[model samples]
Target: MTSDVRDTAVKDAARHEARLLWAGNRGLFALLAAARHTGPIARVPKLGWVVTDPVLARRVLNDHATFTMDGEGGVGHLWTQLFGPEMAQFFGGARHAEVRTRARDLFTEDGARSLVERSQGPWYAELARRLAGGETIDVADATRVLAGRLVSDLLGLPTDRDDDAFRAVFAAGERLAGLAMGTTASTELDPEVVERAREIVAEITSGVDAAYRAAGAGTILGRCREMDLGLPLARGLATLLAIAGTETGASGTSRTVALLHDTGQQHALLRDPGLMENAVREGLRVSTPAPVIGRHVARDAEVEGQRLRAGERILLLTYLATTGVGPFDIRREYVPETRQLWFGGGRHLCLGAAVARLQITRMLETLHSTGRPYRVVSRRAARRVLVPTYASLRIETHD
Candidate 1:
């Protein structure tokens, strides 16, 4: 496609994306829209500090001592309310480092590829076969099931059940994450909300106790037992896995599929299968599933000439930071300043980054398996949720 055509296509894709944001969370859509012109950093009323620059966001994320996850404005604070202060150790304590260290091998690139294939390869094959037969598939719903399956396999949750069981797994995680929708301004949750969140957490961890007891050494719960971390924290960690791995992975997968179709890049990718990796990178870069990252100002610090006092909160607008570079282009090179701000930075960088990338790549491969571009039949944006995503995106191979 010509430059003009590609630009128009990109804008069209962006408009649909904007609608998803608006439908899902109007407040976030407004913040991102306004941040475009707010320069690098700005202080917003009631929302604390907002960082739009990728470099600045990375700086704040990397400054663990100055910006923390366990205080009033951080994600850890939200978790502590539901799981209790003991759960705070998973955020900032030495236990955090130890857990990541122990779980490191499980998230490595090779490990991620193995895990995806072992847990989800058959599903992808079946999806590709269905598409080839010209059957419309709900990409959005399928992703949720696929994500749930991966999480269950990873945690040694029972896999003898059907897709509905896994969908229930994903729904429980989504409801739990939705509870945090009101936490943008403050990380503290009301007693009622905390109670509700705990109920959802219990649903997510219903199988954890059994898994922890009998899971093989290869599973995360079994590893927790080997570490003697006890059942409560193990349940907390299991719930964390459900949230961290489910919504974001499903959102990224479906959104990427929509982007490739909407932007008319499917043809380019079909012509050159070697661009598969580029397509995946560009998809995650553009979708930016975990858009806003919250950090507590642990100590006074200066960033880009602005002084951030201790106890204040800062919201890193990662979605804006990542997308500001340009529209999605499979040929786009790696960005240095932004790095992987979408996954975060420093010691807290997303442990599942590799798995997320591979999952998206695998989805794209499955769609292209028949050597034909797919067409979007219809889509509906998920509303009243923390993450902006499709509730259902129907598609089939183009005739």
Candidate 2:
């Protein structure tokens, strides 16, 4: 077939598969089946277009020469708008490394320690209070509030006092979620979405700008500005941080809670509180908030005897990979010394992974330590949107 015909065929198949995966529960099972039967499945005309075998996943993510994390293939345009033009370019190759390095200091162990001590504690207290009211609460929204508060604290933004700013961030998250789920057309831009996007950008920019101005002249943002990274880069980092920090945490928390309640794993963890850490890791491994990470084929590459041309998009189903879909087994613990790749394999590995772990660990600890018997009142699939996330996790505390 001609390249155009091939491309059209792949696109059509991807759309159908995306709908089934996003619209129903079968997508989850399909992922598991793909992982089990084949090392990697080149699914055409279904919900998941490609299931990256463990080996292939390792190769694609690790071999920067073969695949790039520029987010260029399918949903690149949508991310470009959300992350801004300059930020989008940085996600590609060498530029991505440069920009990622500048912001690395903020996500380091020390940085996370400071954030947890100064910020997370307060956020946790607030969440506990809200739950203490004895009313059934949406865990998803509660988690979002916690994540949002963390972002606000980190950027020195006035989120807690400013409901308008908080709402804007929440709305931007909603729009981005829609785009990620494949439910919304990338070409169709909603003016309201645009306004919300602009609001989030402005709020984040203003927060970082204020931080720069208030710093004793040698802060992180100050150093970036001095290095010629400019305000836009700062803004981009802040924006990216806000989205990544909030949504991932929110989704992970709600899903972990739901999974625990549904599987009766929460009680086990509560019985042995020290196991909370392990449970957190297992939850992440099982549900994997960011289940799908995409890459663009930088050049021609072959996997499992199939050839993929340059510029073709491939998705790494990390969540599926974790569920014993391939060679790796989730039943085994991820010892840093023994495990191959979990937080990603290559240079594009998640920068905020450490902080993310810390936040998740803390949240799980808090939940278990509460000693309140809580059960999932209702658990349902989230609305069709770009990113697949749990729509609501209603829990009722009994004791």
- Alpha-carbon TM-score of each model against the true structure: 0.98, 0.76
What are the runs in model 1 whose C-alpha is more than 4 Å off?
Answer: none
Task: Name the TM-score of candidate 2.
Answer: 0.76
What does candidate 2's lDDT look like per residue over 1-399, in tens digits?
Answer: 466754554354334333434553444445545545655757444332365456667776777767765544434445566556776666664666765676677778888767765666875665566567766767766666667667776665654464455645655665555544431212334566656667756754666777655543223455456556667766776666677777777666766676566545566676667676666676666556666666667788777788877866677776666645322122345644213344666776767777777777776665554587687676555555434456666776777
Clashing pairs in 1: none
Model 2's lDDT to the true fold?
0.60
Q: How many backbone clashes does candidate 1 have?
A: 0
**lDDT by residue (tens digit), candidate 1, 16-114:** 889889998898898899889988999999999999989989988888999999998999898888778788877888888888889889999999999
Model 1, residue 93: distance off in Å is: 1.3
